[model samples]
Structures are given as C-alpha cells and as structure tokens.
Target: MRGGNQMSQLMKQAQKMQEDLAAAQEEVALMKAEATAGGGMVRLVMGAGHQVETLEINPDVVDPQDLEMLQDLLTAAFNDAASQLDQMTQERMAEVAGGGLGLPGF
Candidate 1:
C-alpha cells in the first residue's frame, strides 16, 4: 500500500503547513510598520493586523484655522501606515506558505 502511505505523508505535510501558517499569522499581527505624511508632520505606526499602535503630529503642522489640512494629513499618514502593514503581512506569510510547497505566489 505504497500509495496509501504516500497519502498519509501528504496529509501530515498539509497539517504541518497549516500549523506554520497559523504561527506566521500571529507573528505578523505583532509586527509593526510606520509612515509619515505632510513632510513628516504626521507620523503613525500600525500593526500588520491593521491596528493603529501610535500617532504623532508635529505642532508646526497644526494650524488653528486649518482643520481640513490637519485631517488630510492624518488620513494620509494612516493610509500609508496601513499599506506598509499589508506588505509586511504578505512577506511574513509568504515565508511560511512558500516553504517548498511549490504553491504559486504564496
């Protein structure tokens, strides 16, 4: 029953891969990425799971009359940080998903 044995081995491999993927996801969630906007006036850090860890704004960019401008900078900074988080997650997951599985674009 060589074929049966091979199937069992394959099942084991798949189970191991699933475990690895779960671990990788947890790692990625803890990973952080950062971004800045408005010439570094707005900065933010985001986790790979899309949670904002921190945000900082330079006082010089905070105009009392320019609420819209301040809002725009904040939005841009958050979006950039989120994009970075996405990239970080993809790269980290790929390390686990591409472990000799011959999977396409893991």
Candidate 2:
C-alpha cells in the first residue's frame, strides 16, 4: 500500500510538470525579439520559435549606387535576430527543462 501511494504521488508530480512545460511552450510562442543593424537602417523581428517574422528597411537606405551595402545591412540584421532568437530559445528551454539537462530535442 505504501509503495502504491508513492507511485501515485510520483505520477501526480509528473503530470504537473507536463502541464507546466506545456504552458511554458505556449508563452514562448507568443514572445518575440527584434534586432537592428546599419545604424538602424534595417531591422529584423524573430519569434521565440526562431522564425523570422518581419524585416524593415529604411527608405533612406535605398541607393542604387550602394546596393551591396544595403544587402549587407539586411544580412547583418537577420543574423543578429537569429542569434538573439537562439539565445532566447536556449534560456527558455533551460527554464523549461529545469536547468537544461542538455535534453534531447529540447
């Protein structure tokens, strides 16, 4: 009987953890991060899931004479946003995994 009671308690704890993880995932989905480059001539927005949501380019940055520079700015903005998104994901997943355990698929 005592063993049965312990098992039941453990099962309950596992279920609660599962619920907490699900809630955390939902919160992450609703979060976003932004990055900018080229003195704010370009901006990138990334979701918590590491997906690019938006890109903004300043009209003043438009210059046929300097298209390569504009392209570089866009790339920098995107890479910055992606780096931030990776960091956010790691932090959140660590919080979810209860200290990151370096779990698989986390």
Candidate 3:
C-alpha cells in the first residue's frame, strides 16, 4: 500500500512537470529575438520557433555592383538571429526543467 502511494505521488509530480514544460514552451513561442550585421545594414528578427519573422535591409547598402557583399551581410544577420533564438529556447527550457530533469535534449 505504501509503494502504491509513492507511485501515485510520483505520477502526480510528473504530470505537474509536464504542465510546466508546456507552459514554458508556450511562453517561448511568443518570444522574439533580433540580430544585425554590417553595422546594422542588415537586420533579422526571429521567432522562438526559429522562423524568420522580419528582415530589414538598409537601402544605402543595396548596390547593384556589389550584390555579393549584400548577400554576405544578409547571411550573417540570419545566422546571428537563428543562434540567438536557439540560445533563448534552450535557456527557457532549462529553466522549465529546473536546470536538469533527466529529459533528453534538455
């Protein structure tokens, strides 16, 4: 009987943890991160789901003769935005997991 009680308590704790994780994920989904490159010539905003939410390019940087440079700046901005979003998601998940919950990829 005591073992059964312990098992029930453990199950309750697990359910609560699951709920917390879901809440954290929902919060993260509403978060956003932004990054820039080429001294702000190119900018990117990323959603928590790693989706590009917005992109801005300075008109002064648009050069018909130097398209490759503009491409490089855009790529760098995108990379930075993606990295920031990834870090933010990881941090939020870690917090939800209480630093480490034996959960895979947490």
Whole-model lDDT per candidate: 0.85, 0.80, 0.86
Model 1 misplacement above 4 A: 100-106
TM-score of 1: 0.83
RMSD of 1: 2.6
> What tens-digit string does per-residue lDDT give for candidate 1 at 1-106?
9999878887887888899998987888688888999899999988756788889999999898999999999999998888888888888887886775444563
Query: lDDT tens digits, residues 1-106, model 2?
Result: 9999878877776777787788877877787889898899898898866778988889999899989999999888888887876777678767767833233664
Better of 2 and 3 by TM-score: 3
Q: TM-scores for all candidates? A: 0.83, 0.79, 0.84
Instruction: Give me the runs in candidate 2 sitting further than 4 Å from their true place.
Output: 48-51, 99-106
Clashing pairs in 2: none
Clashes (N, CA, C under 3 Å) per candidate: 0, 0, 0
Query: In terms of TM-score, which candidate is strongest?
Result: 3
Higher TM-score: candidate 1 or 2? 1
Ranking by lDDT: 3, 1, 2
Sorting all predicted structures by TM-score, with the top scorer first, yields 3, 1, 2
